[model samples]
Target: MPIRIDRFENGPNDVLDLKAGTQPHIVLTFLATNNEQAFTQTEIHEATDIPRGSVGVVLSRLEDRGLVRHHGRYWAIGDDERLASYAAQQAASSASTTDDYYGESDE
Candidate 1:
């Protein structure tokens, strides 16, 4: 099949660059899931199984982008508006996949 170059060109490219299983994605999802509390870099590394050095680097990058915030040794999800929309999109996508897999209920 030929690649649709026109479609690619027409689509917006400013979308968040997060992709499943990426270091940033893994870290963001973990923090977003446990947004009520902050964690240290070591904790994030242990929980996400990413290298400790990589975790710090990823967090620094995310902080620079305003996608995450930190205070002292603790880090938490950021308040960026894009994050809320991204989370909603993720939830909707998950729901759609689940419905497709198990069939939607009539209730």
Candidate 2:
């Protein structure tokens, strides 16, 4: 008999990268957009489409950077002001790394 897995997972040797808060930043932004609520790792994994292992690692790095916090068994976004500043910096970095494909004009 063959085993059936539910959630899709990356290979064991796949590289894990949060892209210096880019991944988690995007995830947090989406979660915040939906609503500010604590979610378990499994929820985050499914919501973000990130491998379970990578989700844990990314969450750990985010916690270390004070971008997120663990309360009880769930995790939540950190301070709003702090998150805003951090996300701004990450966006700036992303912008500098890639040109604006949208052709946005400065006011």
Candidate 3:
């Protein structure tokens, strides 16, 4: 059976569990890790192999969410804290989902 989404509550924030292997997750992780640098669409497409069109869409969403910034001809990370928080939330959700898949729960 498929496991229900694992979510956690932290005060006012409701964080949902997300699959970490998705293109968005991968791109987010990459951008976050290389926060000190910037890259153009072509460069990102080459490095991530995410297809040029998808790269543009991903960048648009991330920019709207304030997770990334567009500077001149390149894109760079916007908020490091949000990126870290998102990654952490995804990780926690994944862990619980794994435990559920194994019919185990950490009490």
Steric collisions counted per model: 0, 0, 0
Query: Distance from true position, residue 89, model 3, in Å?
Result: 12
Local error of candidate 3 at 48, Å? 0.8
What is the RMSD, in Å, between candidate 1 and the native fold over all Cα?
7.6
After the best TM-score superposition of candidate 2, give how far the Cα of residue 23 lies from its true spot, in angstroms: 3.1
Task: Put down candidate 3 lDDT per residue, 1-107, tens digits, no spaces.
Answer: 55345533323252222357777666776776566688998988888889889988888877777778897889977766867776566566656766756775678
Model 1 C-alpha lDDT per residue in residues 5-99, reported as the tens digit of each score: 99678976644457888999999988876767899999999999999889988998789789899999999989888877666665666567767
Q: For residue 90, what is the lDDT in candidate 3?
A: 52
Give the poorly placed runs of model 2, Cα more than 4 Å off.
1-22, 84-107
TM-score: which is higher, 2 or 3? 3
Whose TM-score is higher: candidate 1's or candidate 3's?
Answer: 1
lDDT assessment of candidate 3: 0.72
Model 1 spans > 4 angstroms off: 1-17, 87-107
The reply for model 3, stretches above 4 Å from the true place, is 1-18, 84-107
State each model's CA lDDT, in order. Answer: 0.83, 0.68, 0.72
Q: Model 1: how far is 49 from its true place, Å?
A: 0.1
Query: Every model's Cα RMSD, please?
Result: 7.6, 10.6, 11.7
Please give the lDDT score for candidate 2.
Answer: 0.68
| Model 2, span 20-107: residue lDDT tens | 3576765665444434578898888888887788778778877777667788778877776867665566566566767867577787
